[model samples]
Target: MKPTRCPWRGWLMLCLVWASGSASAALPIEHWTQPNGARVYLVRSDSLPMLDVQIDVDGGSRRDPPAQAGLAAATALLLTQGVQASPAGPALDENAVVEAWADLGAQFGASAGSDRLSIQLRTLTQPDVLDAAVALASRQLAAPAWADPVWARERARLTAAWREAQTRPDTWAGRRFADAVYRSHPYGQEARPETWAAIDTAALRDFYRRHARPCDARITLVGALDRASATRVVDRLLAGWANHGCTALPAVPEVAPLTRPERVQLPFAAAQAQVLVGQPGIARDDPDFLAILVGNHILGGGGFTSRLMQELREKRGLTYGVFSQFSPGRHAGAFSVSVQTRPDQADQAVELIHSELRRFVEQGPTEQELAEAQAALVNGFALRLDSNRKLLDNVAALAWHGLPLDYLDRWTAQVGAIDRDRIVRAWQRVLHPDRLVTVVVGATP
Candidate 1:
């Protein structure tokens, strides 16, 4: 289903003219649970004749066994390669599966992220086409073949890609940074050649069976379907999926916070030094997520207007560009600042980052800064929902994270209401300037 090797023959791209207004004003979401226990979220967009669907399962890399770090990713990849035969249909190999979708003028794919494994489909809303595409997707979701030959080929390709990535200095720095920040947490686990080699067909199948269940599905549908049609589509797509009395999974430990400053220095023969700094940050469900988001935009996430870019790039000429980010997830993800500069200036760059972060944490953003950030974010919010595909992704996120149904409707207003004092309070509570981790690779002696 990954349209990579075998392309769709009759794929038609849909175009629409989205009206200019508050994004929340236009999106009205409907939610319900199927009898099989899958949670469904739908947004009816009648302006287009296409349908976009996304299914999110809790089988992301975070669920992988420590010994087989990339198991979830590999499993997601193989789902599209082939499917086993069942009473509903005959078996289909990778090429045959691709041809089936191509003939239907639809696209389907599966990929794993840090928190979830997502299966997505895009197809025309014609009755005949929609039914066929949903049936094919159901085959992929319910009956992945997990063929040994395909795993062997994928592993080799991934291993070679891994080897090539290792030759880059940024990769070395990133690995060290993750290990230092996450320590014993599963969030830090990166698949190695040996780990990829260790994963066989059996482990992939086991992971899928355990995690990819109807009970755990958060399905989102967006496009030209009303509630009735959307409900029927959901039922048909999940017809082959059966609940097996789902039980709770053993909980993975949360990402631990750093107790003290940690520094990693690795010398590599490269032109520029890669410097990374920071520690564990907020989780997705944190009440202060909006405040922290605004705080980060002022710190480094607002691009040219961000403090980090203004200081490190524009004023001091330390690097061509620099950035800070908060990668919040089910658990605490990293809050990192990254930069590349001359080997000789690595230390200076790190110190500037430390000072800027410390000052911002101690004294929150100015009122003027907060106003500008709010205006920029609020005005541009509508672009986030300009297409059905984009809306599907947002709806899927809301379902997966248990965010309020009105979250999108209130996004801009809530962001605008965040004051300077709240931003300061959030920064002080969330970030520890003294306990940051620093990783500098390819630095001069």
Candidate 2:
């Protein structure tokens, strides 16, 4: 699981490369449903001696009860740390579980996120090892130990970690940025000291039971297994699963827009001011997603060649680097621009950001800029799916988010179809330069 308050990494890049004639063979994503109502997606690849299987549910931090912010993450971590029981075998505990997989030369890892909780296993393609790994996964999902001692230790560890996070400048900036941009939305919620204190073992269990439903989850498998064999493995492993469902979390409310330009100042005396700008962005299913991707690259999602980088770093040397991202979740996601600069330059940074955003909305990307961005997006897009694990993540996201199966195949086509007019029009619809939220931590008075 992630160790920090903010787990999302900046996505998109400048100079994203596209090799004009390069062709990528589309891997078929096999889809099916288990009797227990779990949706499954599979892609068999014999290229590796190993197989990667991932189980994802919609039990992300967004499901954390307002009173107990870290409950979702704690439950995810405690799964591997406790006893897991299969239908007929003796229960396996933390160490035993680790040794069992090690004995088979396989790896088991899991983490919870803002959108989902995932347990991933990597094992050599031996039939016995694969079978055991799948069985172990099912057990972990169906029956985590839910023991008091394990909960106590994890709670203490998380409390200490979050308490310490408060002392760091980066953490300070992130917390303020999230609060300012997301306002009352769950996406802005972070685990505070009191949030930790309120979450006991019972809270964790209840949160897990209600939100971690297999019926509400998607299973993705990649590497070294055919449809028939994989089907048998999944069916047997998850046979004990039941379709009993629980109450669903409130539908994520519509993300509120910034009614006016507001700047939040956090008193951190670090050398540079951390400025984050912008507001809610397109969602995964938003038709504008591809266009936003292409346009954002030209704006700031692209690394150095992005307009923000060009303005903030290349032209003024106000910061070493500045980047932007369109972070999509179950609901509308956030679109933000961030940079760290000399504390004294905070005002200038914010002004420059607004100026560039104004120009971007009014003028849009140039033909040369769009062409370069498209090339980079198309080229980098192939590399993003080059590995089995990457393929599993990409496909699992699609399966979980209910995007069309052909979404991957259509990715490049969509990126190619994005033009200056569409890009400009998207920015105009999605962003309001005057209504953006600004967070300046460590700024000079």
Candidate 3:
């Protein structure tokens, strides 16, 4: 007897296996604007019969009013909670909506990040399955119920979780850090229980209507579909998502830089102290992005070998681990170094961190350090695109940032070309050592 063939889920696994071997090579991105005004980016992969789609709009937390801090997040979440009845079908309660996707063996969900509200879908490319999945997703996107009871229940649950999280020291450190780093910017506006309570179904609907428009969508597709099939998929997915005549939203101002060093120390009953340091970093479109990325790897991003890790963890045994990263987004995002240590050692750890950062900003990385960071990044670049999902994410980011279509093709070259001078210049231009923000929670006051 012959072996049994795998089903849809198994086909996806097979696709990953097949794609992994070739993922290291550059994927050609096809671009076009749909008649409906949506921008679509495609990476066609015929390795298996599956499709992954991501749709992004400028409906993120940044669009939320400070008083309604989580309005965008709530809107995205409720999109799939229930969908209104339509000419094509009856209404779908949250449970029924979930079951419908299950029956089709497809997945669809929405989320809000700092700068984008995104809806994603994955389905087998069998003609009937793809069509049904697309149609269902279209309905959910176009006709969210914004039901009162559902929002109430979700809000209660979220509020409960938020309350619990507040009890933790790390949460306090993070929230306080964000406030100091962003000041009056929307990026600093974290949702509280009170903020969640302020958002109602009506607010959600209004936010969805204003921000989730076709003209603002950046859609990315990666799968076995050709350009024609992908176009059809997009059309069906956004069929009735008519444009609202590209009305410009009020311009969100850039994050304001700190005028001087700000320090916050909060007392708590815990054995470990949570320490966060650094300041506002670069935007995703910053010219020094690659240099900052590479330089950071040498300073703190790289594990074990990073200067921060070596100084704080290896040499002093201050903590188990310490890491730094730049959270680059649509606007300037935070660059932070975080570590946890004994409550008594909080001041020492912070001082050492500041000392290391100041030294790095002044002298930059050594020639050997730059070479190693570049080699590690270049050699490991293939892993970043070793699956369909990864490819979809990369393509989506490129589309969102208006980056060169060949960006991925030049990733390794760009990373390899970073010399000491470039890294030094980039770091010097971006980071300000004197104006760093330091926050310590659970420290001995």
Candidate 4:
């Protein structure tokens, strides 16, 4: 029997099926252990023909040996410079592997944060491309060549970069803010010229061996791939890599509340002062985190609707933008309000921010404000899953923080349940406006 299809009706049916399918599709999360005792999270999505592989080692700058402060950062950066398989012969340079990866439309980049060192690769999902990426990453991870010439060049480059950072107002403000908040903890130390100078090839090798191990690492896979195929890719590429079985470093010391105001002045002719103000806040697992987040949004975390933005930008035209964020590290992290305003208005801007913060602490946000904040947060929560990359980020963060598998499913509900009283109490518990550390770069007062 010949079936006649109506073109318009068929298209409508197809659209309905696709919409229903997408609606029913769960965020696919598959976890498995590798032979080397490493944990891997696989997120399978065929939305795009790309793959993102992220390897997170437990040691970052916080694990830097006492003397070699920047060792972790330097080692993470140099991981892909060259490997034993692609060592620099007489003619080839150590950067040969790095250049090769670039030429192949693959990028190998690493970042050092408070808790972990992350190495990420983004590449197409073709079998050959994926194979090359995996091989390249495996070689870089397992057997970094750390050629002397390349080390020397990179060290010089980093030293110069560090020197340059010292002169930048934003850099100065961030470094000062971190130092002020963490205060004598390894988390406080900024990479300096002396620290970069201390990093030698031997030191880098020791740092890498101690920290970058399969046992001490976790892998996150995202983008267009299936679980079965992604598992095979990770296993074949990373399974044979040996684990060094290194112990985790001692936890960062709890940051005591800032006793007094601390300030740093960076000399610059810029029109606006870069102001950073805050102290250490809650960890990721804190039950009151959502309430505090909502409170902060009303206070300064929300862009235009926040109190700080209203007081500084909307009402008084003091600054272009003012915002606050609470960055939750493995340990306690910073809760900061940042603003940039003309130097003459710096003191006024700081005072207005403080006034709003105090109001939040004392009076708390109104029920209407809280409701709006929660609604916005809950409504926007799904946007985090709009892309595979973002979903992978959430997966990585969840795995890193030991969050439950159903964390995302419950996130919006939890946020939506936060009430005005809860937000007020959370604000009072976590924020001490009076004890905040303020860094003003390019301002005298």
Strongest candidate by lDDT = 3
Expressed as tens digits, the lDDT of each residue in 307-423 for candidate 2 is 999998999999999998999877778888998999889899889988999899889999999999999988888777866667777888888889888989998888888889998
Off by over 4 Å in 3: 1-25
Task: Give each model's whole-structure lDDT.
Answer: 0.88, 0.77, 0.90, 0.75
User: In angstroms, how far off is 2's CA in candidate 2?
Assistant: 34
RMSD of each: 3.1, 6.8, 2.9, 7.5
Candidates 1 and 4 compared: the better one by lDDT is: 1
lDDT of 1 at 182: 92
Candidate 1, 253-340: lDDT as tens digits: 8887788999999899999999999999989999999999988888999999999999999999999999999999999999999999
Better of 2 and 4 by lDDT: 2
> For model 4, how does the per-residue alpha-carbon lDDT over 1-445 read when each residue is reduced to its tens digit?
7344222334333433332223111675788887677788877766555677888877777787656788788887777677775341222245577555654566677778877988887766766766776777666666777788887888889888887877678887898899889887777777776777778888888777767667766888876788778777677556535565556656666657777767566656777789988898988888887788888888888889988888899899998899999987766788889999888788888788788888889999888888888888877776676655566678888878777778778888888887777877888888887788888888865
Using Cα atoms with residue i matched to residue i, what is each candidate's TM-score against the true structure?
0.95, 0.91, 0.97, 0.87
Colliding residue pairs in candidate 3: none
Candidate 4: C-alpha lDDT: 0.75
| TM-score of model 1 (CA atoms) | 0.95
lDDT of 1 at 442: 99
Model 4 misplacement above 4 A:
1-25, 86-95, 102-104, 263-269
**Predicted candidate 1: what Cα RMSD to the true structure?**
3.1
